[model samples]
Target: MFPFPPSLPPVATESAEDLAEQSEIEYGTLEGGSTMAFFRDSKIETYQKMWRYMESKRPSVFVPTIEEGVKRVLEGNYAFLMESTMLDYTIQRNCNLTQVGGLLNSNSYGIATPIGSPWRDKISLAILELQEKGIIQMLYSKWWKNTGDVCNRDEKNKDSKANALGVENIG
Candidate 1:
């Protein structure tokens, strides 16, 4: 189905603009030409650049949610631009996905505790201790890399009850 070169067009070898132009040339917009998709909800500035690029070929191709965007990428002819952490985690979990290029921008994340919460410092210290002991990296490898086929990815298929990701959800 791919009419581009033997190698993928989005490789680190070319600029983002070049990739878009090449794909636009090969597939043409109506034929599901190569396109960049992003989480429509993202407020990040660099992501706006991506939106501009997508707009050039065809604006209607954008996906409204990260989940839907990822699905479209897998379905073909679409490349989903996402935050590095989430993208890396998703790629690690799925053997079929590969990152085409380096990060366009970077952002730092922290373990946020509400203002004046007693657990703030305690949580920070705990994270530091875990990092010092390499537990964080170990967990990253365990969850992201090694899980592979051993883990069931569909949430509905899980046998155990699952809790949501907020402190309020903890038992």
Candidate 2:
């Protein structure tokens, strides 16, 4: 019988093809079940695409909370595919886990406004102004990169390359 943490060889998870192979390894075994985790309620298009990708390959678990998925990965033999932002936050806090692979797709966040609200234009303009002045970028660097509580990841380590996930090793 396969062990709880199966004795699968280390497989590359840095590309879509690699991830597909990893999923195959997990789902091919007798005890294999749910080697990937996705948040159950996410309606974002990119997230949905990832869900479809994984589901098409094999069945995986959906966790109600992000914390559950994080915990599952920590327990081993699992991968949690999530937004780079949240993945960065979690990796900074928990050194045991690092992001695997780059983003499967790209998306942008928008400031939500009530329907027909007059403040929408004002808020949109302010966000654009911040972007133009690089305030948003500065804030992201401060919180995501330079936080005091963050784990000091080694650049030489392959898995620690979370920041450049989208740019590096695109295959």
**TM-score per candidate, chains pooled:** 0.57, 0.65
Clashes by residue pair, model 2: none
Candidate 1 lDDT at 132 equals 100
lDDT of 1 by residue, 92-168 (tens): 55545555545444456698778999999999899999999999999978887677553343446332222122332
lDDT of 2 by residue, 126-167 (tens): 999999999999999898878887777677765355333444
Deviation of model 2 at 73, angstroms: 1.1
Model 2 TM-score (2 dp) = 0.65
lDDT of each: 0.49, 0.54
Say which candidate scores most in lDDT.
2
The candidate scoring highest on TM-score is 2
Which residue ranges in model 2 land beyond 4 Å of their true spot? 1-9, 23-60, 114-116, 162-171
Candidate 1: where are CA atoms >4 Å away?
A: 1-7, 10-49, 55-59, 150-171
